[model samples]
Target: MKVSTLRMALLIMISIGGVNGCGGSGSSNTNDKSVSPTTPLAPETSQGITWEPGVFEGASNFAGRCATPRSGVDPFTGASYPDVEGSAFEEKMWMRSWTNNTYLWYDEVDDNNPADFTVASYFAQLKTNGVTPSGSAKDNFHFSQSTDEYNTLAQTGVTASYGFSWEFISSVPPRQLLVRYTEPNSPAALAGVPRGASLLRVNNVDFVNNNTQEGVDALNQALFPSQSGETAVFEFALIDGSTLNVTLTSQDIVVSPVQNVTVIDGAAGKTGYFQFNTFIRTAQSELIASFNTFIDENITELVIDLRYNGGGLLALASQLSYMVAGPNQTNNMAFETLQFNDKHPEVDPITGVEIQPTPFYQYEIDYAAGLLTNTLLPSVSLTKLYVITTGTTCSASEAVINALRGINLEVVQIGTPTCGKPYGFYPTDNCGTTYFSIQFQGVNEKGFGDYADGFIPSSSPSFEYEVPGCIVPDDFSHALGDVNEGMLFAALAHASTGACPATTLAGNAFERAAGQHKDGLSIKRPDALKSSIFLQNKILVPINAPK
Candidate 1:
């Protein structure tokens, strides 16, 4: 049902209740969007609800009804397929998911908008604009869909792309993307696409041909491919203003989370440095191997680079927390806690079974997910770990930081404020599009989980809606693990001194480049959709109830 229609329906109840025997002065249900046992109807207090009820057509794509179980259109691919929401079919599903599942539900959305809101129009309204993380009553973080991408990226630590992820440098027309990084042996890496390279053109099209939206549309079409083996020629400008053109075929690029691992022989000691990109199942083996090497090296301190990581699997996150804290330090403690919504019992809502507080996982979950494998996960059991971040660091990644603190470990957070997201959900797919609504917020053993606007540098005064911590900007000129790089250097210095480096304000590299940055910084918008993190890899509950 459209938000407008839903609002009208909400109002009708008041009058209808008085006319019929359903009289009640005000909504008795505290959870407004939820359907309580006594109040079958969800509540809404939007001004739009006061208008006469508009027809609940949904997005013209749903044929005026949800739960039709028909294929939806892929707006990106225009494919008549199952699971993806390119079609008009998703408006109803999207509305229903938030109405039924989100923590705030009816209190924070545009409920009175026309039932005719398109997918893009409605989605735009849902985004939290300038809203910091500390404001928990309303949710503005956008982008929710199928877990298909999440599952693949987490399970194998791979994705079907040209072996590289990118960031768009141009905000206006003729938008150009900068190659963020390439998977070591993937097609893009083989094609010699270097980090910080300017993607000037794609498949003969000028990325910013002329019109603003047109350029964006062109870049999206050429860069984002739905299937593997799709071929596209990329043109990049190298450091010397020289142009290099290379043709690449897309494939499932294995993203070993441990991008670069080494023992840094610094003034402090032999510190183990690990640059992690994503939290995938494939990370387990490499992580174990790396820690074993760390133990062999007798490393006293550790530095973890998570500047580019947007979270992945929570289980892997738990495993990593365990590895860093070890059994001796974190013995029998809650790695994190997952609390369900108010509508359900304080337990696993779907299984009707109970579960312990999310613990630090010590072993890899089986392929069938039936048994916990006997293979032991490795750990260093350090008292502290140095972590680097950018605004992109989020979700399960934040969980690692949170869980470690929960178990009495010191996590020296270096870099700028992290993307404050203590909430997570199992991606659910239905009617061709996947749905993800925030179901719970997590806390540490100290019962402190409210870091919504993000953890800022320690020097910044504690104010409303701010997370206090170290502050630093991303350093693009130096490679990640290099001790001289901005964030890493700050972390290394803090590892020994235990004092946070001064917060460095991020520069407008886009303006500096006008297309390319002289300092070799990659182009990224902190608020862009690409920067948002979706940490999956939990027990997903597929919600398909259509009424």
Candidate 2:
């Protein structure tokens, strides 16, 4: 199947709530395009343009015409300038028409006049205000960012940071934060910051007890600095009850998506374990190399750690799933099939191609070139798989579990419920802002995709939504890949004994704390606190057109 370059070429971002706080919002000077509920709609004659029912093609005529037209070559598409001077009303018109044509629940959206709102605010109100089965906002993933920043993060995985990935134990007053992990050679790792160290203060501002908005802003500014060379002093409470202070400088850090690939000898057998982070282009080579090692070592079982993995490319997920199940089981089978809104049942509304299933890709893909290579991918062909998850595990990460289970493979999940998201979209750019609105729902081979409430691990699973596993709390004291870590230990133990271990006091305490705090902690990079909604957590199409 030939994938359209316009539809396939880009990264998809997913919102993993609880970066700053579960409800704290992020903003950008260039691309802050959300509407406040209290903001009144503009008058019909505000811009001397009245609302009209129109199709997306009618809006396409106004697409390249920006209110403030940009000059020079476009960095992302490598195309010449097509922009022309236009009014903001024209931009808002484009947003309305495009959203009407593509948004999954377009019928549920209110047809407000475009003249009454700014382009950003107008685009924000284009989604449905419905709630999911779990009572969470149904269209929470609708958001936008600058086209340049979106492409840069998707392709390069580089972001400004001081290098500490934080896990929020609590996001309210008296917040409890801990170091989840650090990038190697980063300022935090170089300063000897270890996992599980509790954050105490930032530049003398009390992080735990600060309640005022001003104090919170100061803390956010210090912890999530926007530029390189910025410095901050941090105090941490170590595991041994000792306190330590460290001064660190921020820099442009490239994220390492794959880490801690180890082979563990257990009573069950040799288990191949790896901590897989994001599903970006950079992760392709690392995953291949790790799978090659596992194949050579003849490991019996596989444990994939996705506790902090938000998500990224869908093609990469397909590749990884292929490596896990191999050719015999996946041959001529669909990995996933996308169903767009009812209007475009037989064809993709975005790509204009006939609806088809995405296959279990068995060969290496040249992501930069957007072509498949002849080299075969390594696979363990295991019938049973182990996955470690958290609420942060979302989008393409959830797809991996769903796709494997669709094929009747045994998947034992360990940890809390996953962030439920089976929807995806091709990032659409108009003017300079790239909008991400849900356009399609992805289902596995069995035609099951309604998982909006998330996948839960339970002792006695009564439905397909529940899987047989232990609900273990995250173990911060022990390293992630350690044999004794809370989640991993339970997974290994369950593999050997086919039963869950007795619930411990620590696990109960963690659950109690989470219950008391409405929104449990999220694992995220320090810089992600503000714009954690734009993090990698969707299934991206390939970046190039098929040859």
Candidate 3:
């Protein structure tokens, strides 16, 4: 599954937002002020509005008060604009109040004056500045994007692209980029840009060694075009020691989140394998179809490649988990239980309803219609699951590994540590911008969600965060799902025999150098090129909210 240019642009924007931490205001007492203001406040000038120190008004008081009020109905939601003419200060106020009320770590945030910063800057510092146990940022998921962009990608999984998802083995000087995979029928695929092809240049700019700011900017623009119909010349070193240059035209492409579905005949019987990229709404049908094939083939083992899957819909994760374990093992068990801040212990702060555990969904969901169909999801009924991971495997993807383990199902992991993110939020759109604040932490049925450092593949596992599996580095030498690929091969061997194959670094010299990075053998993407914050999260739609 390849990333769309729009998705890449959004990810770059998110990267910028992360660097400029979400700004905040003076510290104040926590309170439930979720109620909408009965009467909208009269429009105020930007200069007239000032922060009242530690005091905060209800978020609703400033909600829909846009600096630039949108007049027409939202094309994505089909709802009339609730936007009212206001200053950017009003938007900042909404962010401040909303963070305090629903943010999982509300008190940890330093409240700086909203007037001191722009709306985007203010929203950036609204999260905790503390670090996790591993010394990583405590809240790495905070971000905001235009509501239109968020809705389009989340709903339809569509993006403008040349359909080349580059795997950044290294992003520094002498950077190494490879075609991780290409979308079916995309320009890259049509150009025969196979996996393992090394990216040498983009439109005459050296992709690997161009260190100048102007050159890097040119590379970013060409590599991630903002709109469809844009064209760029790419030079690639193909697998068979041949160089090829192709001019790819970016087009609007629907992402096929599930790809390479196959039933592999192995010593352990037929093993079902598929690379699941994102958990978007459209993935529901694709997943069902794949699982139905597994059922039909009577595969005894399952290998899910989530090395590039950052995540998407939480409900989709639940459904996938149910299908893996089936009704007998997960019949009445909660796939995950969401825990909110103490202020809203018994209720969800955003939905204003009693907290409920997310169950194993057994039926198909019409996400577009917001209805559950009567179609029973096909089950593999497997006792064990094989997962291929990397630092990019995150959120809903991690939830699958954790939830299955909670039910005592064996999950043999391959590759390096996963991008630990047991946290999630409801993407709340106020005015024209959607704010994604960490609202809750999800625990499995066993009440374990503390893998903030990430779930590591280890030979000797001592904690829940560590799982028994081979510590294999990704192989760029072979295409994903190919039996010769390092990760999948390790999984298949482990399935056939009860032992992991001996670790051997595969791929070319650049790949080996990437594996030898100080951070280990995992693919290293620039913060800007990392998976989109939208994808690297467990997004929730309030049960009571409009579909």
Best by TM-score: 2
lDDT of 1 by residue, 225-312 (tens): 6568899888888766789999988887666678779998886888999888766556767888889999999999998887666666
Report residue 75 deviation for candidate 3 (angstroms).
1.5
lDDT value, residue 171 of candidate 2: 62
Worst 10 residues of 3 by lDDT: 1-10
> CA lDDT of 507 in candidate 3?
25
Question: Model 2 reaches what TM-score against the true structure?
Answer: 0.89
Ranking the candidates on TM-score from highest down gives 2, 3, 1
Give stretches of model 2 more than 4 Å off: 1-34, 37-48, 53-57, 504-536, 542-547
lDDT of 3 by residue, 1-547 (tens): 1101000001111211111121122222122122212234444476566678678778888888888999988887688899888888788888998888899999987777666565666676788867767666777677777777777777777777889776665665677788888999999899989999998999999887877778877888888767799999999998889999999999987888899999999898999999988887788889999999999999999999988887777778878988998889988787788899999988877767677777777767667655555678988888999999877787888889999999899999988777778888888898778878888888988999999868988777999999988788878889898999989999999999888886533322112444433422222343333225444666776322122
Model 3 ranges with Cα > 4 A deviation: 1-48, 504-534, 543-547
Estimate, for each residue in 378-421, the C-alpha lDDT of model 2 and write its tens digit: 89999999999777777788888999999988989988877777
Q: lDDT of each prediction vs. the true structure?
A: 0.55, 0.75, 0.75
Q: How many steric overlaps does candidate 1 have? A: 17
As for TM-score, the candidate ahead, 1 or 3, is: 3
Q: What CA root-mean-square deviation does each model show from the true structure?
A: 12.5, 4.3, 7.8
